[model samples]
Target: MRIRIVLTFILLATGLLGCTEQRATVAVPQTAQASFSWFEYQGSDPVFAEPLAPDQYQNPVVAGFFPDPSITRRGDDYYMAVSSFTYTPGVPILHSRDLVNWQLIGHALTRESQLDVSGARGSRGIFAPTLRYHDGVFYMITTLIDNGGNFFVTATDPAGPWSDPVWLPELDGIDPDIFFDDDGRVYIAHNGPPPGEPLYEGHRAIWLWEFDPKLQKVKASSGRIIVNGGVDLSKQPIWIEAPHLYKINDWYYLLCAEGGTADEHSEVVFRTRSLDQAFEPYEGNPILTQRDLDPSRPDPITTAGHADIVQTPDGEWWAIFLATRAYDQRFYNTGREAFLLPVSWQDDWPTILPAGETVTYRPVRPAGLDNHPVLEPLTGNFTWRDEFNQPALNFHWSLLRDFARQWLKIANDKLQVQPQAGRLSSLEPVSFIGRRQQHMHYRASTALTLSASGLSAGITALQSEAYHYYLGVRRSSNGTTIFLEQADGEGVDIIASEQLSVSGDTEIGLAIEGDKDKVRFFYQLDGETWLPLGGSFDGKLLSTQVAGGFVGTMLGLHSRLEKQDI
Candidate 1:
């Protein structure tokens, strides 16, 4: 009788406890997409961390062509601006909360009324802009490469309806930086050829001047030579530009990026007690460098300079500098990306990476973190497939010239592209389908089924107007054949021609592989085994230095004919 009563009591208690445990263990599903994976060299299929994810690191967190980054923190918000370098809408403004994530809000220059960059080269647009917020107004100062010298623009909102450019008629130099002192005085620092000479022939010096905020100009009499490399060649005697000013405690610090922004680039820091005095070189100059990283591996981080310092909300200090990561050890993909380094105050000066090394692995997050923001992913996993219902082109696509509406349309879940009545060289032809190179060794394949009445439809690797590499099928006099062409700086011509028996409404796929020096081409018909078309092509034909445009070399799609039918 006692055992039977105990069994009923035990059964009821066990059922109640099981329900409680189930409720406690269950978790709500996350609404957002999957978190980005971090870059681990040891992982078998390593994935890159999100652009600015909360759980993982956000790298090059700022997107696009943000070269020569200048950042500042006001309260909880961070504002940054970068060199636009010949792009039409210039000096893009970005906002961020944590250093790892950023978003582009607006452009400082919209109308070309004040400055025109119609014919500017790739790296010759707006140079080194300094962003500052003071007295309820935000100020951005930069230099226009081809037009007026240094200019300033102001706005109340970080995402701006910015005021027109205030040209500083007296300031004459490039890579201009503005420093607003604690006492309400504004100073402009720049580099130029000595008073009556040119900068391209030889090296130059740094100049400082007091700027008038109301007049929107530099007081002509205020110009003075702060540092002259001609006086001491031991200062490296090379290009010393992008001077940034920061006041730490009682001393004023002037830091600059040295070298020609190539493999030999470095970061140099100097300081003084007064703005008028010559900056004393730091005993441990070049606090950060990658010159000695590896003897076998090409230095991964080249052009590591143009640093901007910001203090976090928790009182931690950090420096954001520009560095380039080469994808193929020859072709640069991360074109001047922003890298963050923690700074510590020692001996009344700022010390970064006290180990005197560059960080390749992601660092640990800062402490006292309750809430972290999620970062957007930069890589779009979509490939050559087109389900063309969207009204606009994808982010991966861009035209060589201004895009036209008539040449392309989307309907019936297919992208309909009409062949223009001109050659591929004509600007009006609108032969455009291009994507940025994400990896050097990866193969790019597209299945293009042409419905046009013409004989040419295929893919091409475009360098510029005079230099390109293309492998495509066309209806020649002999039959349909896949032709390979390479254009040096001289002219475009057939390199290796092979005749094929392929007919109408067929699928074409092309693959390009190799480093920047040598590119190989391959093709497959109807998803068959790929046949090697061309090997070890000269990569000089696809270089931005030789191409003369604001865009990098792009892999493009085209439909063309040698002569149009009457």
Candidate 2:
């Protein structure tokens, strides 16, 4: 085996193409190669995997980078949608009969006409979405920040050919939620600027508008500021956003997320008897927050807010909120995850969690629901393996801001991903596909066959363009070498590399493990023992706190041209 420095660039590998996908239009080197025989991801978090009573369930009903969750119910069936940011196939739609075991149905935004995030940053595309079902129609209202403003898509079925976006140019704000009153009234609520001069930085208000379902537009001259500066103005609340409205009995309830989406993040509520009346703040505001707890608490869950509440057919109320579980306090790489909590009603007021109370990691299952068969485990310690045998990609896989073209092919039960010039950091969408890093103590591995003239192709743990870790293998004229590459705000750097004695095309295995703050990278050849390619590195670099993005870490196969400049 000849030893040599490995200078290789990694590209983003995507999921297998559908049967009708056209040929890829992107140019690639003739010798480029990235084919995976199998990919597997497993998680073993004791806190989540602990034995639970049949009446109990995991807190994070939907895990990983799925954030700003909004749920809607259609009789006994429940459907959910979450923010996908810059990834194509934007809002993932999940379905559940019991609301505890959810299954991926499809995406709400699949076509370029529905979601165009081109030239947007990794964390800058799709914002909070409010999914609602009324009168046999499903509506998903959301904000597409940079390219477009607010919009709504409609579909008869949530697992959809969701209609092209009906852009809401008149609306101004994020997390646009639609509410239908029993009195044949339609309203829209969102987070945006106050009526006049701002009181302070992050001083925002909740605005309400009467929307016309028939005309598909906001009623002219019907917009008004409903809540200013959150629950209180003199108290000086910051970043009051993600407003969700509900009406229980005669009182109209308004829920909003406050205090910027960090440790200070929280959920608050207000109530009024009618829309014409002013909403009064709850006497005990900030129904949910984790900032007051000690930072030294073990396996702390922080940034708990952004809730959307729904009622079951049995008259039970449950709230689905976004929160972060950090191995170390305030630092989490898995991003904001969807948590489940029962909403307790107190004297005609709905409360999720009391102030200063820690969010529970495990909660009793919703009572009066039948024992729905487990389709698959969304929470707890579970292993998911994909053999590339299916004709179409699994809904779990994600594609970053790219059109659904033929960037990948599945033949002989192997996923073959062509190489691309653009690295993951480029403003242009790279040809990459990855799954959200769901667990802090999980391992992701894949087995791929590298060509004799091997191009760069391997595992990547990506948070954003500026912050990502790439474990790639390439074959130079000297020999084959595996390297661990990382990029931060500063730039990309090769941290570790090892030359292999393999002379020809070989099946190589790559793996990455994230244990709290520490992350390790590894690679192996011909089913041999996995050898460490890099030392245990700080995993916080891949977290939202460090990366400064709303997205979580993605762990899966990513590839790039072997000749691209660092």
Candidate 3:
């Protein structure tokens, strides 16, 4: 909600005007301002529209770069949140009545004061978040990697204006999950370094601390290490993170994501009769994993772990975790997605999926959920369009960081973007708003009236500061120049460009298409036919394999201003 403040300032200061075909004749600063008549973006992928039986639900209930999912329920209403990293309004909060049908309600962190991702890299700010509800308050506890340490925010209503961070300086670590005990006590569990130093490469520990819900702080001297180096340090389990503590059947169970976040990621379980006692690793330690499955399997869902289990009103147990849908070999542009599965108990140990079992595409619906299909599917192939008609931008749309300064606004169904000096190569926030590239074979396009000034306003498929593609139209006395620039290790290189003697009012249609490992850029002056701007470029660089981040590709509307104004 605070984004509106930054946008409003930008709109007024930059001579905000109602966007129309005629408004393009009115010129602002040639170097640093541009507004859109209306921006339209849609995805065309064929994988999401399959026929679903009345009794089954899709595996990835929520798709895209939404990873490290944490969920809580109140009666029949369920609320979930996912990690957003440096993108702000960080921590997208979603609501689901039937657990299968979900809607993005709002964001947990919105204001600049609430979340300052100023100097953080593309995937370096926010880490895994664990959302919980206790005593009529929703708590989102997580770590800030490059910014601050562990902190949490609270809100009476999950969809709302959450309080600012209450920093947990003493409770250091990432992926912090808060547990409210049945006996009126509170605890926080997180993945941290092992006691007394480094044991192995991926050696990590799960630590617990006594938390005071009243004071809203961690109690000093109540810290303890619950699981050292995963289920067993001798085996040297790597990246034992994302710990969620739950009490069921009178036993405190500690569940965590084992191994690094790759093909080897898995969830393991440990339990103890009391919090003060040593935890006993489950006989079948890694209760859930796809690592042992054949890599060449068809339509595979790999890198599954970081799971959190919840119970329905009917006492049915279900789990939500993060996984990836990859093509070729571990090449996923859609990022880590949220997957759903059922929890089955074997000899009192909760298991999401058996060791050798492959995660299914369509799983049976939770025991008693009514058939409520989502209006827009997040899984598989789906198309999403935004005309900027809403009072605010959709929660799914993201800025590079907090919308803290003058950059953009939404007015009269148009997304008015004021071009900024920062380019996609700068670590700081740029004049950009993006949506997840949610499919292996997909296309996203937008229409914008070019300023013909010192700005190039068009579309971008961005992976990071240095790894992205920009296709924009710049208008000047020299006429309209449509160009495509690719950013990578060496630097920005113009892949292709074209010159045209065009007017400023022409609503230029720009689009980006990605097919697995490659991408293409296009632009249109007539708004119907797409003229190629650049040949196919390597889309693999957008994947985590080359970009090396915790996020996926984002197709965004970008307008970069000239460095030296003429």
Model 1 off-target regions past 4 Å?
Answer: 1-65, 103-115, 135-137, 155-164, 195-202, 230-232, 327-334, 354-356, 366-375, 379-438, 441-485, 494-566
Off by over 4 Å in 2: 1-31, 452-454, 564-566
Cα lDDT for residue 421, candidate 2: 55
The positional error of residue 254 in candidate 2, measured at the CA in angstroms, is 0.6
Give the top-scoring candidate (TM-score).
Answer: 2
Tell me how far the alpha carbon of residue 81 in candidate 3 is from the true structure, in angstroms, after superposition: 0.8
**TM-scores across all candidates?**
0.71, 0.93, 0.92
Q: What is candidate 3's local distance difference test score?
A: 0.80
Sort every candidate by lDDT, greatest first.
Answer: 2, 3, 1
In candidate 1, where is summed lDDT lowest over 10 consecutive residues? 36-45
Candidate numbers, best TM-score first, in rank order:
2, 3, 1
Q: Report every candidate's CA lDDT.
A: 0.60, 0.84, 0.80
Summarize candidate 2's per-residue lDDT along 510-556 as a digit string, tens digits.
99988978889988876979888768997878988888879999887
